[model samples]
Target: MTRSRAGGGQKKIPTALNATYYAQRASAGLMITEATQVSSLSTAYPNTPGIFTSEQTTGWKLVTDAVHQQGGRIFLQLWHAGRVAHPLWHPEAATPVGPSAIAAQGQTFTPQGMQPYVTPRALEIAEIIEIVHQFRQGAENALLAGFDGVEIHGAFGYIIDQFLQDNANQRTDRHGGSLENRTRFLLEVVEAVTQVWGAQRVGIKLSPSNTYNGMADSNPVETFSYAIEALNSFDLAYVHLMETSEADLRHGGHKIPTSLFRPIYKGTLIVNGGYTKETATAALAENNADLVSFGNLFVANPDLPDRFRFNAPLNQPDSSTFYAAPCDDSTENCGFEKGYTDYSFFSQLEASSRAE
Candidate 1:
């Protein structure tokens, strides 16, 4: 859910528009902000927000304060794009860094336009340890920004996903070639972040059946089973799991459902992927998951929980406006409200009907 409207700059500070958008959706049980870069080199797209700098942390405080005014809880998602990032976003680095030197087979949105993925420099062991520290710093920054917690972005073919999947990680080092080795980076990051926020306020996202950014595992079940079971050692807030999408299946991904890991995971499990009220209720009723999360549904329906309560119609999402709109002037605001904060609430629609 990267709206990509934080505005372009070295800081990539969250704008007032971001505060308004999240505040409007404050009705969600728990609001998780868009994937936020943990460091300068962690960016893969233009205008995504960051948590590393003082200015960015201050900007996020606006969002947290606004949401808290409405009695809402929020978590900042910490992300590192890794090989998915292009040189356009990280000119200081030689190239994007990953577990191995291989490049993902896809393109990423950049300031220049969509560019083909590039081969990344394999990270040294010391560099990997530094990245773990970066995640720790991000968790600390989240607390400073007034977030209720922080969710590590280990899903969606990012740096952690690149290490977890074998196709993207061909190294024979301790970071690759085995389930334990591949998951080491993720565990270290989790451990580091937990030290800052403690296990109860930290969560990790995993997409075992994900096929985006050329991600695939030789054995997803075994890989994720070990990862989920290992998480039992920590009393985390929740483990967010994504169901395999149609796009994943089209890309030859294994049909490893999130339910497969429910039994293995020893804590609260949150399942996501195109869930409606009915399916979400069924999931909770059948004990398939402890909780269910909505992404796209919440995008166009800011008062989504109320809509579910009243069985109201939903506002259709405009995919074109899902991300930041192009602006001729780089310095001007790009109308982020068109498909964002402008989404009408259920009460507004009912009032409109009464007036008509």
Candidate 2:
């Protein structure tokens, strides 16, 4: 699920209510929570969730309790929007921070308005260490919130991805330029979070070819391959990869099997993006990935794993409601009521005989 941005106009989904939503769909083998900010300044979009506040912690506890009651496993996705963030979202209206002062060349949706991306302040070495501490604390908060594990958001055009790419990280210090320096922040954050969650409870999400929000690595292949190799030392629980986007096709354009990196790393691999049931099965059969993560598909179909297993019809999510509005005060108030969320599951729409 998508996460809310920090200091956004929308109020956060109450934890007691989010628990109802997640608990209602506990059939999946695993459920990944919406993108959650590690720090207040890390907010990318308005209305996104955060791991920083005590209220947020107390709120997530409701979600975990509901999922656990139904024997479901859930992972919290820790995120930082980086250059995609707008100044208005910051508490002090401070400029966003990244590996460099480069701004994303796109629009960022914020509470105030759709703002143009602004050049961010490059982080200092000490600030980098403090950011790693934020991630560590976020991981600890996730455990306290009752999540089974935590997934570091190192993909898309987020802060970690920015630091991993040379084009975005033009610094000369120990944190930029070369491959080693470029990936330093990622390594530090991983190590810091791993120290709290342990190897088995920590997973990472990465998108090597993604060029979203003006992210372009001069040598993404070399950068990511080296990154995977480095991560081997941590023995992480899993590595989730969003394979092949518009950015990948433009740069290098090499479509390697998701399994290509499987042998290179020693951990469970989850492949996402443009995957079908057959494709997911093939990925598992070929040992390309240990698991598959479906975003839009799963968002609409709460019983996705069951639908796939039983060959049941899937629900088509209403694109309008994906990020349309906040959940209403009443748990029964569906997103569709506000012209936002709509999906007809097999159990609710198709013939009962065809339902699983």
Candidate 3:
């Protein structure tokens, strides 16, 4: 691990990012861009990137160019915090909306101090369509910015997940009730995004029993099983699963194995959550997962795949600077704050593996 200039411990910033950061870690089979929002209303933090604006798309061009320069394939993760959003961080501060009006239990970080969540206004059918359009536009923007593909952020108790969960969605519209009804919103979203990027260039992520932001499902197994089958109809790039642990599982819910859903889903299955190098390797070796996504490991060690292959030591992440705005301030729209974008991948790998 490199020494932090802060003296005793690692600095709260990820210096290894940038062109060199991706170049150093160019060995991964695929690299998914960090979770990026689809619109201004989707903002949830100080430095997280959004795909809604032209400037944001331009900023991401630099990133994809760098990864490609290093011979790596990258996909952009399209996200919307849903009810997890804080009003202070958005243009409509204190007015963030969700599927239902139920307020989340935890405090949300905002420009102001942590504040209690307010009940989100239920989205009307027309508004729901608008949201889908936003996602479609984001997918188009991603392609315009030169991303290989886009992953719909359906997991982690986000907006789409909220609509999927019975506890979070109490409406009586086409978007609420019955497993089919609840998952309708997400399916529609996938369809909309696919229209722009094609099913092969699009994917979806889901958490069967995640409780983040107070999300819950009456029957996650049935709910997700049904959802997975529906996802298969689209023939998406992959169905990324976030397996819930024993503690995270709710009552009346069944634990689902990635293998069990394999038959239902005819596409690639990428599994995530609490996965280590050994576990990731075993998942691939055992055919349990087609790909494994390392969250923090990828965050701290950009060259994580190579590090795992060669058993190189890894760098721990800096929790403080993770959300801290970069000095250059471009982070207001994109995650990168400084001229961090100016840095390029290692030149040696590029010269040898440059794409035709």
Predicted model with the maximum lDDT:
1
Better of 1 and 3 by TM-score: 1
Q: 168, model 3: CA deviation in Å?
A: 0.4
Could you list the CA RMSD of all candidates, in the order they appear? 2.4, 3.1, 6.6
Please report the TM-score between candidate 1 and the true structure: 0.95
Give the better candidate number (1 or 2) by TM-score. 1
Residue-level lDDT for 51 in candidate 1: 92
Ordered by lDDT, highest first, the candidates read: 1, 2, 3
What C-alpha lDDT, on a 0 to 100 scale, does residue 70 get in candidate 3? 81
Q: What is the descending TM-score order? A: 1, 2, 3
| Residue lDDT tens for model 2, 1-356 | 67332222333433554676677668888888888888878767656778887777877888899999999999998888877777776788888889888888778776656778889998888989989999999899999999999999998889999999877889999998788888889999999999999988999999877877777776777889999989999999998888886556775455645666787888888999878899889888888889998887877776777688678877776666676443333343433232122344456445455553
lDDT of 1 by residue, 59-125 (tens): 9999999999988999999999998888877756448889888988878777678889999999999
RMSD of 1: 2.4
**Candidate 2 vs candidate 3: which has greater lDDT?**
2
Q: What tens-digit string does per-residue lDDT give for candidate 3 at 127-230?
A: 88889998999899899988899889998778999999888998887788888889998998999999998999898888886777777777777888899988
lDDT of model number 2: 0.78
Best by TM-score: 1
Superposed by TM-score, candidate 1 places the C-alpha of residue 181 at a distance from the truth, in angstroms, of: 1.1
Candidate 1 residue spans exceeding 4 A from truth: 326-332, 348-356
